[model samples]
Target chain A: MTRVVLVPGALALLPEYASQVDPVAELRAAALAAVRWLGPEAAVLGDTQGERVAAALMGAAGVRRGGTAAYLVVGNGSAKRSEKAPGHLDERSFGFDAALGDALVAGDLSGVDWSLADELWASVDGLRRASPLVSGSAAVDYADDPYGVQYWVMRWGS
Target chain B: MTLRLGRHEFDDDRTLMMAIVNRTPDSFYDKGATWAEDKAFDRVAQVVDEGAEMVDIGGIKAAPGEEIDEVEEKRRVVDFVARIRAAYPSLVISVDTWRASVGDAVCEAGADVLNDAWGGADPALVDVAAKHDVALICTHTGGAVPRTRPYRVEYDDVVRSAIDDTVAYAERALAAGVARESLVIDPAHDFGKNTFHSLEITRRLGEMVATGWPVLVSLSNKDFVGESLDLPVGERLTGTLAATAVCALAGARIYRVHEVVETRQVVDMVNTIVGRRLPARAIRGLQ
Candidate 1:
């Protein structure tokens, strides 16, 4: 049997069943649907909301955060860069302050010590010079983009 | 303030954190977020507390500029770095800009390295780096990208071209005076490439190791990761870590990620596999 290189295309939100249901709730369902495609031995590491999708996966396989079957979370700040254009949030779009990002990321993790200023500030300090406000003007303007939220969660737990 | 400056040194081979500090108000996410020096310092302290190994500071932004006078740019850059250095004396700092004067100013103010987006745009910047013996990272920027291409410009071959261009730029920087050991290469993922181009380059970044210098893959939730999956900026964590892991497997020496703790974990895991390898095999009957 040929070894498959599984590269799940970017996670897609499910089509809205109706106007009443929350889109995020529907997205959670779609994410759960996508988890079925992963191989047993394969582990996942990427960004998403907190651990809802991963939690759902855990329910399916009967696992926990640090159990035999495990996944990780790396909550993101924004989803996409521009409004009209489409793309994943780049490092440059993580958040406003370290504290804000930490608060957001804290929602996704457990057992890790999270303070007010998680790591957003350091991330900001490192790249701000190369990617100054003047340069990132376009992205800033696109803040209203639905996918521009700067949170990412990677599922590693089973 | 206690600031230290060095490369991304890992602690117990876990993860190394290099926090980002933007002095410019025009930065993408928190545009005008750090317009005030106190606010910038507060952010810096937050990253340090959260666990960052080094801090990178920049006066100018990453996008193309309309040929501003080199002297004015240098003066503006050095002034801010000087202030930062004085205020936070113990922080390990890196200055981001391709101007020679800016490099000199930061070094004079005690910065440890010079991160050049244009990879020595003025060549004098190379001299500044040599004079201070500062570590360097070079990223390739397009002179201009055709508007017709919109975000998706053409690359002869994304991976090969990126590596070649980076190596060429590194060679030039080295020839001008920057030391090889102090040199690092960034493929300039978002400088001009469109979504597809960025993804192609990032996914196949291992090819960059052949360039013979440490590669720093700074793909912290970049645009390509979002577009590929139709994710909004807020929903890119899965994509970001996935991208980081891909580059790490490609032999990236340093990963400039925004999500520190998470990226740190992935880097630790990937580096374990990349750092260790069964020794090279004897050539075909040559040995």
Candidate 2:
């Protein structure tokens, strides 16, 4: 059976980037839980910074890199969802994130527009690469944009 | 090292703000604002609301004045310490006195620390602190007599003298049965030293901190800052906070100040800059 877990590539999730008060506490909790469910070892796919966040979550879950049937993908939706977002406001961010989120939950990305995704400041490189491996309904553990940056934690099993 | 200030225990990384609550009518900064009991109580409430961890209640001003006897000093501060203790059980109450008799009375009334501003003028003050199991602030006054201003005081090396004298006083307090963690050293800026001497002490404060003993700096609106910046008492806050930041960078554990909120902010910011403290709730670019 193939298992897949998705978490946001939030730099705040890294131990070195921690603050006295956690800013992404809820997202971190959901991400950690979903990542832990991915089991002992999983191949990680993400950008450089996303890889750091994935490594931190794996370390926290006490999972080492080894052969496994699980795959962990670090990516996130639009960062320009609102005026306060890191990329500032983009009117096209909401629709882009909605379609992207739907495609991710449905484990289908053949219809996703990469150009629109880039215009909305979405981090979906890893998601695009891993979409071929995800072929079942995803259990969405979390979905929010508390800091004007959309984040999601989802898991798919087959 | 963990600090045991009477009934309270603070972790090694924790820095404390000891707010000044004067019971004297002639204190330089406030100038009789909290001289009355009710006013002093209100001051305590204000400082506690402002997030001060401790209060240093002084009966007599540092400057020489009409003689305030031990009985008078105890009358001014001991009962007030008891009253504050009853109201705020967790607030660390420190009595600023060099008199053993007043120290004993205030400790009996629930004072947690004896801040000997005169640098162990009363030889038995340490014994009183040890008996009550309270923390003692071992200060360096350059051997000047209590209540007397510095008059052309010169030292071979002011920093060395400060370190030597304060460490010796801390050792004496330890020998007198005071807990090692309960001892804090202060350079006593502007207490018995000229402006230049105080400035040197502030510059070389890391040497005192390097003694492996927790250092407390009482540099709030002192003459050293005023002379350094040519500002009077009310205008010396900026200079004082500047001095405070330097001391915080040097690893001072406690700040004795007239302005608790400002001093706390400066110390915390400096500590964060030095990587000794994490940002309060940072998510600026990491999000």
Candidate 3:
């Protein structure tokens, strides 16, 4: 399955799109929802636009400082129609996530170099074998096109 | 019979919207639709339903440097045109080709117009178009016919060069027995132009209108837009709409575009501006 690793602090809270513009609040909500899908052991952390937050989030997401796995650096950016947190991400970090939606969902960890990006993507074939984030039924279909993948993580039953 | 291509009307107000159906296997967009009879026919119906007055079917990719083998080109053209002909018997079909052999097959298969990029440099194509009694849109981009002198940005005469090339193409069509009115002329906007020259010609499109026949202005998503707006092809829609508005204001009878809905709106708005000078009408009526 494709591996999608998201580092916190990559997200922004922009008021321009305020169905509700509160990032911390939305992250809390997302955390609550993800636990339903990923189980209670799944830790939820938000990525602020700061570097320290990025490093901590990347570490928490299991992205070693210098490894390659498909990374979906989710932060404040609009899909153009909805509220997205705003913070500048270098183009590759932003673009790769947007291009390959499937890879971000599958969490494919191989072929990715995490050090090259504050955020990036790779296929972690082993993670699928070990992690409950993807179930046996889900593992078969997790790897997706690796072009541009930015995903909101939900580890399999927590 | 009076004919209309799209929004620009002739005798019958039914403007023929000639949807450009490129069946090139490597077309920039919609490449997979080529040679697949079902997909190609579906595209034909889609464009026609989208209010295309006619469908311009082609086998070769128009983007620079891509060439199709003459035999395969002819076969694809014939097969697609014949199918469209059989399906929409009353539809006005224009064959997009500079190649004489392919042009011959489609024309013989009941294509109504010959839209040539080279302006009849191929004498045989002109003869084919003439024999088929089809209307011809003679177009010239600067590159299609090499300039003995490198194209100068400083034109001692912009209108003369545009009209001269168009007139020459019209003369060739006339010599081939195409009716004078049936020949439409376009100022091949980006085909051989620097920005200033292109803008200059566009600003003075009336000079082309002065040539007496109808004018077809095709500034759709061309280099001029990309260079000016610094936008890729997909993002050139707004720029395309602006150029179409300018072309319509300058009296271009037909506008070739990828974004049909917006192009139609811009032209209709321009037509409204031309049809009734609203401010003047409003002032006089109020007075």
Candidate 4:
């Protein structure tokens, strides 16, 4: 079976950046559960900051990095969804995120408009690389933008 | 070392606020304000609400005043200790007295600590603390008599003298069967020392803390703060909190204070700044 899990590259998930009262507790819980489900050892696919978040989540779940059929990808949707978002309000953010979320759930990245994603501040490089191998419906664990930045925890297995 | 205050125990890193509740009609601060039993009880309630971990109930004023004998001292504090004990079961109750008889009575009435603010005037006070298995606050007053003002009391080396005297008193308490964890040493501020001496003690409080006995500092609007900033009792809170920050940095375990909320904030802030404590909920830019 080929398993793939996607989590947000949230800096808040890193132990060094942790606060006494966690701001992304629900997101962190969902991410950890999805990552742990990927198995004891797996390959991580992400950009520089995404790799750091992947390593931290791996460490927290006590999962080692090694060659495996399972894959963990760190990515998130637009950061300009609302006025309080990291990139501030953008009229195209909601539509861009809705398209991204649909693509992730359908296991297809052919419809992801790269230019619009860049304008919306979306992290989808690793998602695009792993899209060909993705198939079947995703078991969505989390999808929210509590801090104005869209995030989702979804898993695809074949 | 963990601190054991009678029925209550605290971890090593914990700092405690011991609020002063005066029952006398002529105490220096808040004179006669809590003289009535109900007013004193209200004061206790207020401090508790303000997050005081302990309350030091005093029957007699520290200064020389109309003579209050052992019988009168017990009359004022014993029943009050019992009442506070029944009211706040988890609050640590400390009695400020140098008399062995009063120590015994308050301990019997559920007092957890005997704050001998007069530097152990009654030698048998330690025995009473040991007999009741309560904590003892051993203080150094430069050998001054109880209730008497300091007159030309000069020390060859004030900090050294404070460490030696307080350590010796702490050892005596240990020898008298008081649990080592229940023994605390204090440099009695403004009790027998002049302003300069008190300031020096506050500056070099770490030496006393290094003695390996949990050090308690009673620096709440005392004469030393008044003299340092040329401010009177009502206006010395800032100076007092400044000195409190110095002591908190030096690792003082307990603070005997007048204003519970203010002193607690100062101590906690200082500890957090020095990396000894964490911010309550630090989420600033990390989120």
* TM-score of each model, in listed order: 0.54, 0.99, 0.57, 0.93
Position A31, candidate 3: lDDT: 30
Q: Against the hidden true structure, what lDDT does model 2 obtain?
A: 0.92
Relative to the unseen true structure, what is the C-alpha lDDT of residue A119 in candidate 2, on a scale of 0 to 100? Answer: 75
- Model 1 lDDT tens row, B1-287: 11112322332223346666777666554565876777877877787776666677867656544344557555545666667667666656787777676677778877877887664466677778778877778776554331112344677787777777678877876787766666778886676678877788777787887666777777766677888889876678788898888877777766665567787677666765565322122111110
Give the share of true interchain contacts found in each model.
0.00, 0.81, 0.00, 0.32
What lDDT does each candidate get? 0.54, 0.92, 0.56, 0.90
Off by over 4 Å in 4: A81-91, A116-133
Off by more than 4 A, model 1: A1-158, B1-15, B64-80, B83-90, B142-152, B273-287
Q: How many backbone clashes does candidate 3 have?
A: 57
B145-245: candidate 4 lDDT, tens digit per residue:
98999999999999899889988998999999999999999998887899999999999999998989999999999999998898887998999999999
What is the per-residue lDDT of model 3 for residues B1-287, given as tens digits with 9 covering 90 to 100? 34333112366222234566777676555555645767778878877777766777777666654456789888778877878888887777887787777777887787877887655556677777677777788785653542222255455666677788778887887898876657788787765667667777788888787777678777777767877899976688888788877877777776665556677777767766675222211211000
The candidate that achieves the highest lDDT relative to the unseen native structure:
2
Name the best candidate (by TM-score): 2
Residue B220 displacement (Å), model 2: 0.7
Per-prediction TM-score, chain A only?
0.29, 0.96, 0.35, 0.96
Which candidate order results from sorting by TM-score in descending order? Answer: 2, 4, 3, 1
Full-model lDDT, candidate 1? 0.54
DockQ of 3: 0.01
Specify the highest-DockQ model's number: 2
